[model samples]
Target: MEEVSTKPSGYKEYVAGLLAGVATVIVGHPFDTVKVKLQKHSTEVEGIKYRNGLHCTVRILATERVRRLYKGATSSFIGVAFESSLVFGIYSHTKNGPQPQVIIPSAAFGGAIISFVLCPSELVKHACNKAELLQCRMQVQGADLIVTGMFPGGSTALLRESVGNAVFFSLNTDSSDPHNLTDVGIGILTGGLGGVAFWSAVLPLDVAKTVIQTAPDKSCQRNPFQIYRRTGVRGCYAGLGPTIVRAFPANAAAIVTWKLAMKLLGIKNE
Candidate 1:
């Protein structure tokens, strides 16, 4: 709990983080909605619901239109806002030294902290609960949805967060000279590629997380490796396309908001 406190960075960093969260939500929710849908539904009903991310987007637009893309935004807004604030607040406090050794572990710690928050938010975003999760949506007519049910796949989430964030924040090593436009250009290039690396590494875990949380069959194995065996490599990478497309702009907006908020708060970038 103390890890989430905004005491470090004079409480301003957390405020900046909240702004960044809103920015991320605004820029990323549609992609996330698609990702969640694909993770949960792509393999259902003979795997014909969505051919790919673009096809999924088109089908949603064609049938349910634009609003469909933002299906879970309301719950997402609260969950992501709080989760982002905690992550950035924790990161700012820990990201003091610019060395890879320092930044990576610190970012990993922040990621570990956020996983607890992310798991439950994931449950809500996917309309999954212990009871609801054990029953298909069609069976939810009178099935009790236990909001307080078991938090599924917590360890898997921890793995994804720690590994993904280590890669995500390591791209910002501070030793580089800003005067060298070439270094900055290289930074941009590596950052984009590294972002892809981060997603590619963890997205399978994410797909597993969704299954553990929302699988309608109670007998479906809760283990991620077992889930992987069932889902296969391609199945687990279900939402990679939209996620890659959204990663660039959405995270850019988050960084922009974080920097702008810090500036407005009269804090120096560390």
Candidate 2:
């Protein structure tokens, strides 16, 4: 029987994920800020508030100064860095193996593993960005007192991407080459689908997360789940459309970047 060697240590993967996160934030924070703001303050004027990503960017830069545009960048630096570290590290290693099914579980596990660091940072950043996030909205949510709000937000991301990837790949094609254009396209499609699926499945959790993360210091009488349920289903997934749009391309970009980095470092897998 062939020997099955042990997978790489979690510590190494964690470091990779963190590094990727940091790199992503540095390159993408400005766009991220604009994306968040548009999602948060969506309006129904003549039907819609903002036209598209470009329009939103133009408006924000014209009005909200480039500096203020990235208000929660510091929090993002921490949150995303940790989140990506485990995500990419585990994903790259596990998916490269024979037993591909491990990818889903590993991805989910990676998300959970890194939540200890990600959740807190995300809570702080999202809370801090609440005002800017909902600038045009009338009754904006607050972003304070969110220590306990970590579970749902943190866990859902894990559940979404990890499980989503697993399910997606299972139903999709079986490609051996990650660098092929078709393979990359499939990855993008799978990522976007996964994002939508995750968002849909955990919209309620996200809504509560948004509330808690945004309003960290509020003394609300309602339970987190209770408030989410009351918002109706659609309300929970308020940003679902944009999120899906972002995920497909954004994650693909990250994957491409990581792969390029690996090649540069002379790393290869059979």
Best of the candidates, lDDT:
1
lDDT of all predictions: 0.73, 0.56
* Shift in Å, residue 61, candidate 1: 8.3
Off by over 4 Å in 1: 1-7, 33-72, 128-148, 174-194, 217-219
- Report lDDT (Cα) of residue 53, candidate 1: 78
TM-score of 2: 0.63
TM-score for each prediction? Answer: 0.72, 0.63
Per residue, candidate 2 scores C-alpha lDDT tens digits across 117-219 of 6566665556455665334222333342233444435554444445544553333323324567786676556544544555556556556666654543336
Give lDDT tens digits, candidate 1, residues 24-120.
Answer: 7898888887776777676756545776778878878988999888876887678778887888778888876667888889889999999988886
C-alpha root-mean-square deviation, each candidate: 6.6, 6.8
User: For model 2, what is the C-alpha lDDT against the true structure?
Assistant: 0.56
